[model samples]
Target: MKRDIQSFLLYLFGFLLLWEWLRPVEQLTKTNHIEMFIIFILLSFAVTFLRLRWIWRTILKLWFILFSLNQFHYQDGFFQLGWLSSLFGELTNNFGMIFAQNWAGLTNVFRTLLFFILLWLMVYLVRYWLLNRKRIFIFFFMTLIYITVLDTFTLYSANVAIVRTVIEGFAVMGMLTYFRILAKENVTSDSLITRKWMRPLVLMIVFSVIVGIISPKFAPIWPDPVPFLKAAADKGGEDKAGTGVGKVGYGADDSQLGGPFIGDDSVVFQSEAVEKNYWKVETKDHYTGKGWIPSGSTLLRFGGDEVIPVFPIHSRVETRDESAALHHFMDYTHLIYPAGIQRVQFERSYDLEMDSTKEKIIILGFDSTPIAPDSYTVQFKVPKYKASDLRQTSVVDLEQINTDFIRKYTQLPENLPERIKELAETITAGETNWFDKAKAVERHFSSSVFTYDQTNVAVPGENDDYVDQFLFETKIGYCDNFSTSMAVLLRSIGIPTRWVKGYTGGEFLKYSDDERQRPIYEVTNNNAHSWVEVYFPNQGWVPFEPTKGFTNNVSVDFTNEDGTPAAAETTAPVTPVPKKDLEENSSKSKESDTSFTFNGIWLSIITFLDQHWKWILLSFVMAGGAVGIMYRIRGKWIPYLYLVQFRLKKKDENIGKAYLVLLGQLERYGLKRKEDQTLRNYARYIDTFFASREMSKLTDRYEQYLYHQKLPEGSWMESRELWENLIKKTIA
Candidate 1:
């Protein structure tokens, strides 16, 4: 009956665990649910029957069967029914469309079921095989590869559901291994795997977490040249590279010579120069039918480097004797003058050595005409030019500049919506200058309903007018939409605007010792940004990051002690602030509170039940009272449970010794003993036969030792053995 009850309890627990694991989806059709339930019930009954005799082996076999079933049907109720239908459907639709869709749906379901079953099988098989074979290295390697590949594939495929399943599987496998290792170590059933595997698993998990955290910075440290250009060229012919030849510009002829098309998050240039903000590659003055092209025809070949001269410089007659005194009249010393400055003469002249091999112009200084440094540090006459004089002068004609370049600014698609143009016009109507109008457009976007959301955004495709979709329907997008919309609006008004991509300033980490000390910078991928670069006449390209909520009023004030303003100060040094350690403290406090709360609740409930119950209640009350008294007395009862368990085990072993001793003592009295009777029963039987005082005493001692007092180690056996030897000598 006891064995039957134990079997029933085990079956109940196993069923509950299985039910929890196979949580059913709510959106399944009623018919599907009924079918699934029937299948599950049948499987459950089979499992229970098998479990009665051999639970572990039956589970392994069931998982294998499920895997086989999935392989046959794709687990989605789809099979390779007919090739002819698939081929016909594909041809009618367009190239493998039907087959691809069917395969995708089928594979999704198959992979889900396969993943679960395989994970269980692998974990069990590895553990079982490891126990017998002890091949730890092979098991570790195989398990690592299997898990890594499984996780990577799922992630790449963007199957979130499968990824979660894989994580759960890993956790279960880790737990199972822990328990099995503990069992092998011969720990008591009540003891958990916390001691055996918890520490090691935690260490491994921490290491993995650390690796994941730092991997992005360490990986992808190198650059990859644009592959999109090559892909476009292959699809379209040489003419495709130039604009408007194919669906996407591909061939060199079609490709814009100055740079790529200015998309939403276009990268202008990336450089390591500390002082330079923009790396100007080429300027467009000529606009062809398609887009802008550089007009400068004089390409000076200095070695292999191609230098396009934007400005023409002519007269340089003499080196000034008082050039050194010019530095005292300057406001700042770090200014870079353009190539056209004629008053500044060369201190030295040098032969321009063309190094085709090294791809650079090497200028050697000679005494004949001292070389003026090609890249020289210069002092700027800043205060001499008033704010009015700082305004840019336009030299090129807007109409004569390559009509193609200007076309990009005015050419809207034939299907361009009227509302979008009207919206742009309304926002910038009051603004007069191009820069002011651009600022107004930027303000409208930054202050409007649009939000930065990566998940909500859509990528541009061949046929899709992604800009229209973003503005009208999806009101949320990333930096791409924000910059793209701004650029288009600026171009519509005949203002040259280009998109720029880079990173933003990251979170600051300050030093612990000094409040004023410089802090370390740690940038992350999340800092990746996109903004706009508007051409300011004299300023060249002035950066405006509208997505960062930058406003026209946001300007740096560089003042001195007497409240006089300074010029030529371009860069601002970012200072870091220390972050408060509140998260760490809060987490620690939560853990401590949770532990105390759990222990308190348990103790309170146990105490309440003890006070109300009858039979075991008195014993529990006594134990509680004893504990309280021990605390009051400052006595050590915390270790009392361990002491009691030890004493009980000792008593059990001594009982067996007492029985053997009693048997030997009985033989000394010249009485035959029965092997089957216990010491207490034999003593009762012997007490009735003998009425002597010694016999009475022996009977009292045996009764007291058996029932009244706990047996001490070897007490009965030693006393009996001594008494029997004395009796044998007297008999002899």
Candidate 2:
């Protein structure tokens, strides 16, 4: 009965330990309670039925079997199961279809194994090494020390969790105490009395509980021991997928480009513009047959009020139709702007810089600062060129082109295959104009010759030219491949072209009336794109869309008359608001906010809860199920624990405990031993009333041991026999 009590309490305490460890696993994997429930049932039942050593062995064997089956599922063809041979092949083949695909599946399996191992090890230590009271105390002391060590590594914010674990630690101490008591020898009923050690043990446990509850919270002095455990929990609870921007990586550094691409639709910025436009971040002139590189020229710095000198060719372009009205706000580091940005307005003064070519703008701040603005408005003049006008311009002679621009844009590695040049020449054979030649090269790639595939895009190997590999071999890739191939082909025929990188105008958002019904575009990292910029004589540099299905609106002008610049289109100028007008608007907004109250916030919360009540109920059900399963498992361990704790660990105290048991048994049979009566006197009264000498003999031995302090040889054995004889008679 005593052993059963110990086992019951120990089993219940095991659940607490299991819960703490499982909480950590939640972060690492999406293990549902059903899976945990199955594991719990298996382990608890095994502990109840199997010996300490066999339990661990059985768990390990089961784990190996499951793991092997999982591996067989992932293996190729029939050969994976064939290795198991006739002896194991039948078993392996039976479950060959069940494979562990995600980390969560694997994590759940591993966590189950770990939980069982911990339980078995704890039982082994207490049953085997915890022999005497001193050893039991030492074992508990060591356990407390380990708990302290764990405290340093646990996430400091989970004080409640820490406290619960500490309480479990006390339960372990209780278990150890019981185990020690159960290990004592068989007792003679005559010498039964409560041990003096019981009071001190109870006091110690109470003191420990008080200390655990009242201890001051302190900051952890070292790194958390299970950092991944906490990280896994936080991520496991989230509904989002994959790491953000970092996964799609930016194009600021060209060396990082030209690899497999994944489109992420997560919006990065929202812009209100006159029309959807290709927002350029920077231009890359030097291509190393692998990736592009900047010219390494110093950037020119300017204040917010300064007019950035962007255009070197001012005379030929008509500015009236080119001005694009836009208002942009984004919390991102890169300053994304449309093809032509002439002026900007900001709420506060900020430092800015333009690259050496004065084509791209860079918002300036400390290196650590992410470039963002509360809000900003820009007026850009996009050069509109008609296809008729571009088609009419004849090809310029190589010597007539700007020497510096020609040298940079026409750069190609010496090892570039000659076939590339031959192909470009063959495609443009009939085109005399530079514009037509460029268009012909662009058309060849934009045709069915290539297909856009992000995952299969081939990266150039060592000693391999990227453009050569893409054009001749793979012929399947995304924007970078098509754009780079066209740029390289155009350069082969003396048409200066450079690679430009930035985001494409993303999906159009709803129209905004506050900004006068301008179309809003939301751009994301998935919108990161690369294209070619062709330098046309006298008309300045223009963009060309070589990528299939993607249009560069800035490069295509439908309004131009035949072979001539179109009539300029004008835009309304935006005027700044006066200080008094801003103040009036702020006051009016404050007045409008008066209707919302704390009660309104509560109503919104209540409405949300009402709608999500099913989910809330499901959560409660899972929690209840977990608790119920643990309790059900606890039921099996209770009986064995009574024997192990009260019988085995406390054999030295049994003489006293057995006598108490007999007294209680007698009292239930209507032969009560009064609290005031001495054991010898009670035995005499029992003998007189029942005419039993068996009780008299037991009483004499008790008096000899208690009054004379005698421990004669075989005296305890004699007492045991006499007490049993009297108890048998009393029952009759």
Which number leads on TM-score? Answer: 2
| Model 2 lDDT tens row, 398-465 | 56576777788788767779999999999999887877788788789767778665444555767778
lDDT string, candidate 1, 673-728, tens digits: 67677654665565555532333444455566767665556655444443343333
How big is the positional error of residue 240 in model 1, measured in Å on the Cα after superposition? 24
Model 1: weakest 10-residue lDDT segment is: 322-331
Q: Which ranges in model 1 have alpha carbons more than 4 Å from their true place?
A: 1-155, 158-400, 409-419, 429-436, 448-481, 492-495, 501-530, 534-545, 551-732
lDDT of 2: 0.59
Which residue segments of model 2 deviate by more than 4 Å? 1-246, 311-314, 318-330, 365-370, 387-400, 555-732
lDDT values of the candidates? 0.40, 0.59
Write down the TM-score of every candidate: 0.30, 0.46
Relative to the true structure, candidate 1 has a C-alpha RMSD (angstroms) of 23.3
